[model samples]
Target: MPLIYQLLLGLVLTLLIPLWPSNTLPFLHLLRSLTTTPMMDGISLAQKAQLHEVADLMLEIYKTLAAMRYIDAQAINPGPHNVSDLLYGLDPAVIYLYSILPYIDKDFATNTAFFNGGIFADFRKSDDVEQGRDPFYGSPSEENFEDEDGPYMRPWVTPLSLLGNHGSAIVYDTRQHHIWIIDQEGWSSTDPALEGVEDGEPDSINRNYFAHIANRPAGDVLRDMVRWYRELKELPGGTEYSDLCWDHWDMDLKSLFEKNGWPDNFDGDAFLVDQAREFCALRAKGDAENPLGEVKKFTDWKNGKADRAKKAQEALDAAQNLNETWKARFELWNAERSVLRNTEELKKAQQEADRLCPNGVCQRPEDLPLWELVAVQRELGWKQNDLSYHRDWAEKSKESDPEEAKTYRAAFYLAEKEVATYEKAYEAAKADADRLCPGRSPKSVAGIKDLDQDDTMRDVQRRTELDVILTRELDALREWAAQIPPEANEAKGMADNQIEGLDKSVEDNQAALKKAQDWIAEEKEKE
Candidate 1:
């Protein structure tokens, strides 16, 4: 037989044989020494020593196995054979043992099961096992005893149909009464429909029946499962798997198998750590650029603030000019009112003259004809020779007559006052009315035929109308000025608030940048 076959035979015998009774320690020890002895190659002493050490380690594993309770082939229901039938009738125990034993005896090179793209079944032939037969029971095809919901129907086992299939290792833990299906990608035994279904029948199989061992890029849970197995086995001297056991076994066992190597999808933890470091460096770079970003933002805010200030000043100047215009209008209005008042007095005097003289004889000096004055002198009965003397006497008498002289002087004064008042009022009203109405001309009081009633009333109405217009314009100007102050204040306030907020933001960013710098410096020092 080949040396590899001898090794395989030895391993099978070790698993099958029960430990000797506790009383037969010496005999058991001798039997183990003879059977578990290393096969020495025809090499130098140093090479021989190394082989012996490896042999000794294998012996230790055997001793640990001796203490463990053997799980007989019969105890495994829906067992390995049933699973292996899907692998074209390969022995499941060979696959299980070949998967785990290499971790202990690193020099063990032969795999006694299907792995990668080849089968290493030299010691035992699978040709005798019936193909496409029910693996649970060695029954004929016509029996129809296969269950639809059994392990054979599971989707995870589909890989077993391939000729050179490599799949997950299944281990039955007799102590826990549960089977642990260890796969790199986690497995779910519960039907997908029954997921998160808590309120089901008492016997319903949920996540409780399944144990998934996911090996993520960052960490592998299979390592924990291996540790749990080791604890259960309780190997002598508390032997531990290597530090790299936590890493993916496919990666850890790269050198051991001929075709099996690290998984193609594996991205090592170092790559992730480097990626995280790069991310941190990028964040630090972003922090370093914060000041410049803030500078640009502050520049925009400054420009906006300047624009708002300029707008506020313009608003204030517009308000001031409006106020000046209103003041000039008000002064003009006041002067017009004064002229109207004087014109009203002149009108009242004319009415008084009409009351004092019902007849048309009491005419004003400007209204009297030259013949009327001479007739009045002739009625005073003075001869031509004594005309001068009489005229002097008549003038003295007139001065002496208080009522006549008072009436004469009042009428003359009234006519002169009316002329002056009308001229002043007309000029003022025309200027103001022209400004207000632009193309329209003011109506003249002199054009009215009824001097006492029509002219007086027209003059009063025009004054009132002009007063209304000036008052309304003044009110609008006041309203505009009133609105500007609040708007200017609001603009100023907004600019101030913007600058203040920008300052605060810049300060905050600077502080963050400082902290980032400190952190970067600290990280550098550590490096």
Candidate 2:
């Protein structure tokens, strides 16, 4: 037997054997003690002894294994001593032992059951067991299991054949009654048995015991083990065992542990504080990297752009309103000016009518002979020889024939005065007609036989001239009212064009601004 089993047996003998009665046989005393002791309330003496034997066997198997290796069938089969066959022969007893030993010492049974084998073996290899051959030689197939990934078999066997040469081990800390699976490749158990496994109760061992180690090299495995050991030591109230199996590993993981600023003896409180600080730093970093801040910035820019667009639109509207107002004012001013111009023209026409016809009579009332007027011009002619002879004859007659000379002279003077009066009237009429109708002419009175015939001819001439003047004035006013002024037309065109251009600009800018706002809103929603 291994020294560990010897020591355990020695302890049991020393601590529990003495409680038996001295009067009875050693076996009967043990049986009585087992039935009576609170620690062995449910287990019989025979069951307790079987549990101890299983624990010793498990210890012996563990002692024979290499570091990180399990005592599976491959490690013991086809050898000088086949522990696998031996275990198979005692399978029924072993099962009974596991079922009953928990009533006496649950931790011992649990540790022995797990470390001795059968529990954590690979199910794929165990399928070979049905063929009456080694359990390590078959492809994994799910036949009776509810889940393809769940446990496949329940027969107790060494885990070495399941693990092969490159896998890890499941270790049981007998002193602490704690089970930990340390596989090079990470492993986890969701089996119902390991759910709430705890110390002192073998039934609970199936529930609470579970652990894993990531796939790594030997050195890394050692480092991880050291780290776990330190962590366990840093737990509240600390662990009971100080010298764990880490010393047996050749790797030095102390530097690796200290490199993270965690001392070998670091407490749990310090670890918690460090983790909190790291969490806060990560949160701040996330805030800095988030795009929500950029979204807000773009939103601000969008608002500013919207405001600018609004103001621009308002300015454009004001400009358009001012242009319309000016146009209306100009139209009103033109209307008033036209009215004033018409009034002035009417006043000038009235003054012209008074100058041309003072007493409503357009001609003189006297009548003169056209022949006498012509004869006078001939008699008084200075450059003509006939008028000189006529004047001389009249002078001679005055001496020779006074009556004849007197008659001649009287006719000549009267004719001359009549011609002068007619000439003055013609000039005045021509001037009045020209002033009232600049491009018009008056009728010729030279051809009129009745110079004083109730002023009919003179009235006709004045009326014709006045009609021409009034007609021309009316045509001019109509022409002025017919069309807009050149400047006003140009101003109106500019206003229309400006308004159109501003409207287009506002439309385009509004669309662009709306697009920007929508994009910003979308981005914010994503954030």
Candidate 3:
């Protein structure tokens, strides 16, 4: 029964040993890891997704632009002086499509405003006036809401509101993959509340107050849409549009959109097809076409337009797909960069800790005083190495004295403590350096702009402590190395070779460190 119990205990011990936790390092390592880990890990997956979306959208716009150019080329064949039948048909589409293209499927543009109107707004904000005229020239006045040409023609390129002379809003719902047009009561429209009306009235503001126009006759609407679309393409999400909404510190989503040259509310569709307005005016002039003839002509025009549109749509789809591909690649690149930075940071923290503490003896008074954790860390590391070497030596030496093998067992434990001390000191020094220098490393500092400042002094002191510790730690390491006796002629030869190489490396490292010190001094002098 006792034998069985012992066997069970041994099995438990063996299993638990593999699961044993590592001894804790200094508080600094923990602190640095805590502070930096979140930043590294905080990268939003949504950001990658957004980048891909932007790239996709840009490519899509590029394709659409290409198609428009193709259509334009067809319209202007045989030199550049005459308009073709195609020109008349394509003009309205171009004007309308291009006007809204810049703002489509973008988070930046307003769903109900025109891009030109936005530009005009900005021009007004800068107090710009055309030819020394009032800044509001041609714009709607408080008393006269109509533009110079009346409600049919707006100072801005938006469509006439059915209820009033207001701009309509347009947006592309990427999720639903459909265009959404919103009606807004134009500035000319009187407010219902002011007229003592409430919600839910047919003409209430809550209704789809903005008119929905078509992308048929592109003319002004197409031109504006194309211009804005091209402009957006230049943004980072566009071609240069920055990831920061309004820029890094801006919190307003709408402002960010506007800054990127997108409409706060797009209404390109309202102006795209002003057929009713045109027809009404033409009918009033008694020049309207016979209904039967007009219908036949309209069918022919519509069929031709549909054929071209189908082609344009196919090109747009291909472009959109390409854009998505590019975006995906960009996201992957960003993700990789982020991961690499995080890994490098982690490695840097570990290296810094090792540098501060050469020997692992955290509790030793000498280890505490030296603080040259980096220089001493190798020495501390050697304790383990030397102990291992000694154990191997002792194993072979067992032919001479079996007890020699046992001697390293205790020293191995001492070596572990010594290594721990060095580790802690190294970690602390690294943390201090990081705090003092932020991103600038001591070795990389070419000048000391703030050398004499209190902040600089704190870092300098930490560095100085590290240097002093390094000096003393090396001396102790030499003493320890000397004590490692040769077990055999072969062992002695190997130890001698290793010690010689280590000594040379140490000297070279010290010389390089001295250069770093000189740089610090130079910076101080300049200060």
lDDT of 3 by residue, 276-330 (tens): 1222222322211232333344445545554555554454455544444333333
TM-score of 3: 0.18
Kindly give the stretch of ten consecutive residues in candidate 3 with the minimal lDDT sum.
70-79
1 versus 2: better lDDT goes to: 2
Judged by lDDT, which candidate is best? 2
What's the best-to-worst order under TM-score? 2, 3, 1
Instruction: Report the error of model 2 at residue 133, Å.
Output: 18
TM-score of each: 0.15, 0.19, 0.18
Give the CA lDDT, 0 to 100, for residue 61 in model 3.
38
Q: Distance (Å) between predicted and true CA of 21, model 1?
A: 20
Backbone Cα, N, C clashes tallied per candidate: 0, 14, 85
Which candidate number has the best TM-score? 2
Ranking of models by lDDT: 2, 3, 1
Tell me the lDDT of model 1 at 343: 51
**Cα lDDT of model 2 overall?**
0.36
